[model samples]
Target: MALVVKYIVDGYHDLMDNKSDPRVNDWFLMSSPFYTLGICLGYVYIVKVLGPKFMESRKPFELKTLLIFYNLFQVIFSSWLFYESCVAGWLTHYSYRCQPVDYSRTPLAMRMVRGCWWYYISKFTEFLDTFFFVLRKKYDHVSTLHVIHHGVMPMSVWFGVKFTPGGHSTFFGFLNTFVHIIMYSYYLLAALGPRYQRYLWWKKYLTAIQMVQFILVMVHAFQLLFIDCNYPKAFVWWIGMHAVMFYFLFSNFYKETYNRNQARKEAKAAAAKAAALNGKPQNGVHQNGVEKNGSQKIGICFTSQTALYEHSSNTNGVKSVTNGYTSEETKTLRNRAFVPNGN
Candidate 1:
C-alpha cells in the first residue's frame, strides 16, 4: 500500500512538472486541479440536492430584473471572449487544418493563454444559470443534461489551460463562446417579458446551431488523427469525443421537445379531417357529445341519448363554426397551417 501510494504521488508530480504549463502555474485556480474540481462538485450538490430542498417550503423569488442583468452580462462577456479568441489565434494566425500550442512567451501566444484562462473562469460564472433556476423553482430546467454539461466544464477546460492553452483544441472554446453569445441574447430578450416573446420563436433554432457547432468541432478535431498535425493526439480525441457526445444529447432533446409536439399536432389535424369527411363534428368532439359554445363538455351525464339529441338539435348541431370560420374555412386554415422551417 505504501509503495502504491508513493508511485501514484510520484506519477502525478512528474506529469505536472513535465506536461503542465508553467506560465499559468501561479494564476488563480491554476495552482492545482483540486480547487476547480471541488468547486464543481459543490455546484452540482447545491443545484441538484440542497437548492430544491431549501425552496420546497419557500415561495419563488421574483428575479426578472436580476435575470435581465445577468443575461446581459453573459452576452457581453461571451462577445468579448469571442473577439479575444479571434484576435489571438483564429482570425489572425491559427490554421484550421493543423495548429499546435505555442508554449513560448510571444505576445500572440500569451494573449491566447490569457484568453483561455478567462474562458475557464467563465464556466464558474455559468453556475448562476442553475442557481437562478433553482431560486425561481424552475426545477424542470435544471435537467440531467443541464447539470452534467455545467458540472464537467470547468475541470475539462482546466486541462486545456494547464497543458495546451492555445492550439487545435481551443476551437471548441471558440465555437462555444460564439454559441453563448447568441444563447444569452435570447435569454436577455426573454427576461424582458411577454412583449419580447415574439422574437423568441427562434428558440428551437438555438439548439440546432449548437448541434452544428459540435459537428464543426468534431470534424476539426478528428481530422487530426488521419493527418500529421503537431497538436496532441490525446487532446484531439478528447475534444472530438466531447463534441460527438453533446451532439447526440442535443439531438435527442430536440426530437423529444419539438418533433414530438409537431407529431401530436399532425395527428390531431388528421383526426379532425377524418371526422369532417365522416359528416361528424370536425373539431375533436363527438356528434353524440353535448356542446356548449362550440366546445364539448366533459363528464356531463345526460339521462339518455334522446336528451343528447334534443340538446344538439337546440344548439343546431353545434354550428361547426370556430372564431368566425365555418367548418370548410377551418379545414382550409388547417391545410395552410405554417410549419416553421427557420428564419
Candidate 2:
C-alpha cells in the first residue's frame, strides 16, 4: 500500500510539477495534489462522519448571524471573481476560442492566471456549505449530489488551473462565478429571515438557472471539438461531458421534485372535483353520506346526483338535502351539472 501510494504521489507530482505553468507554481496549492486530496478527505470525514456524530450529543447550533455573514462573504467573493474573470477574459485578452494559456509575464495573462487560481481556491471554500449544514443539524441538506459536487470541484479544477489556466476553458470558471453570485445572493436573502420569504418565491427558478448554466457550459465546451481550436481537445471533451452529466442529474432532480409536485396537484384537483360531484366535501366527509352547506370546501359544489334536488335550510342555518325538487331553476341546474360547463 505504501509503495502504491508513493507511486501515485510521484506520478501526480511529476505531471503537476513538471508540466504546469511556472507562473502558477507560487500560487497556493496550485501544484499540490496532496493538499487538495487531504482537504477533500478531511472535509468529507468531518461533515459526513465526525460532525454528525459530535452533533448527536449536542444541540444544533443556531448560527444565524454567522450564516448571514458567510453568505454575504460568498456574494462578495463571487462578485470579485466574476469581475476578475470578465476583465481577464472578455474585457481584455480573450478571443472566445482557442485562447491558449499565456505563460508569459504579460499583465492581462497573469491576471487571468490569478483569476483561475482564485476560482480553484474558491472550490475549497465551498466546503463550508456542508459544514454549515452539519452544524445546524440540517443533514438532509448534505445530500449525495451536494457532497459530490462540492468534493470533486477542488480536485477537478486544480488541474484546470495547473495546466490550462486562462484559456478558452476559463469560460467555465467565469460562468460558474456568475452563477454563484446569484446563488449566494439567494442564500444571503434566505438567511435574513421570514420577511424575505415573499421575494424568495423565485427559489424554484434557481434550479432552472442551474440547468441553463450547465447547458451553456456544455455548449461552450462542445463547440471546441467542432472548431479547430488549439485548446486541448481532451480537456474540452472532459468539460463538455461533465457539463452534460450534471445537466442530466439536475434535470432528473427538477422533474422528480417539481414535476411530481405538479402531478400531485393535478391529482388533488381531480379528486376534489370527484368529491364535489359525489356530494362529499373535501374538508370533512360526513358520516350520513350527505353534503351540508356552510361547510367550507375547496372549489366546487357537492351533490349526490345530477337529477332534481332541493337544498333546504334547517333551524341551525345549515343547508341540508331534501327529497323535493324545486321546479324553478331546474333547467339552469341541468345546464350547470349534466351539460358541459365550458365557456
Candidate 3:
C-alpha cells in the first residue's frame, strides 16, 4: 500500500512537470488526475453507497430551496461560460475549421484558455446534480447512464484543459455550455413547482436538445480530419468518438421514453375505440353505450346474455330493445352488449 501511494504521487509530479502550457499549470485540479478522480469516486461512494444507506431509516430530504438555488446558479454560470466561449472562439481570431490551442500570452488567447478551464471545472459542479438527488433520496433518478455521463465528463474535460485548452475542439465546450444554460434554466423553472408547469412541457425536449448538441459536436470534430491545420488529430478523433457515444445514449433514451410509450398509448386507445365501436347498441344510435337522446343508461360491458336481459321487461316477448338482445340466438351468442347496471 505504501509503495502504491508513493508510485501514484511520483507519477502525479512527473505528469505535472511535463506541462508546456504555463497558463494552465497553476489552475485548480490541473496538476494531477488524482484529485479529480478522487473527488469523483468520493461522490460515487457518497451518493451510491453512504448516502442511500444513511437515508434507509429516514425520510427523504426535500431540499427544495437548495435545488432552486443550485439550478439558478447553474443557469447563470453556464450562461457566463457560454458567453466567454463565444467571445473567445468566435469573436476573436479563431479559425472555425482547424484552430489550434493558443499557447500565447495574448489577451484574447488567454480568455479562450480561461474559458476552457471554466468549462472543465463546470463538469465538477455538475456532480451537484446527482448530490441533490441523493439528498432527496431520489435513487431512481440516479440511473447507470446518469452516473456514467457525469463521471466520465470531468475526466474527459480535464484532458481538454490539460492538453488542448483552446482550438476547434473547444467549440464542443461552447455548444455544450449553451445547451446547459437552457437546460439548467428549465430545471430552475421546474423546481419552482406548479406555477411553472405550463412552461415545463418543453422538459421532454431537453433530451432532444442534448442529442442535437452531440450531433453538432460530431460534425464539427469530423471536419478537422478532412482539412489541413494545426489542431491535433488525436483530440479531434476523441471528440468525434465521445460525441457519437453520447448521441447513441441520448437517442436510445428518447426512443424508449417517448416513442415506445407513445406507440403503446396509441395501441391502447385504438383497442378501446374498437371495443366501443363493436359494442354500439345495435342501431349505432348510442354514444359510449349511452343513448344520444339521454333516454337510457346503458353501459358497455362484456357479460353473459342471461345476466344482461334477465332483469329487462319481457311483457310481449317481442324481444328487448333496452338491453340490445334481440333473439335467443343473438342472446346466446356471447357477444359484447350495452348492459345497464341496476336498470
User: Best by TM-score, which number?
Assistant: 1
Estimated TM-score for each candidate = 0.82, 0.78, 0.77
The collision pairs in model 2 are none
Candidate with more favorable, higher TM-score: 2 or 3: 2
Q: Against the unseen true structure, what C-alpha lDDT does each candidate score? A: 0.85, 0.78, 0.80
The root-mean-square deviation over C-alpha atoms between each candidate and the true structure, in angstroms, is 10.1, 8.7, 7.9
Off by over 4 Å in 1: 275-343
Q: Per lDDT, what order, best first? A: 1, 3, 2
What residue runs in model 2 are displaced by over 4 Å at the alpha carbon? 1-13, 281-343
How much is 162 displaced in model 1, in angstroms? 0.6
Candidate 3 regions exceeding 4 Å error are 1-15, 278-343
Tens-digit per-residue lDDT, 77-117, candidate 3: 99999889888876566776778888888898888888888
Q: Of the candidates numbered 1 and 3, which has the greater TM-score value?
A: 1
Q: Pairs clashing in candidate 1? A: none
**Minimal lDDT window, size 10, model 1:** 334-343
Q: Compared to the true structure, candidate 2 yields what TM-score?
A: 0.78
Clashes of each: 0, 0, 0
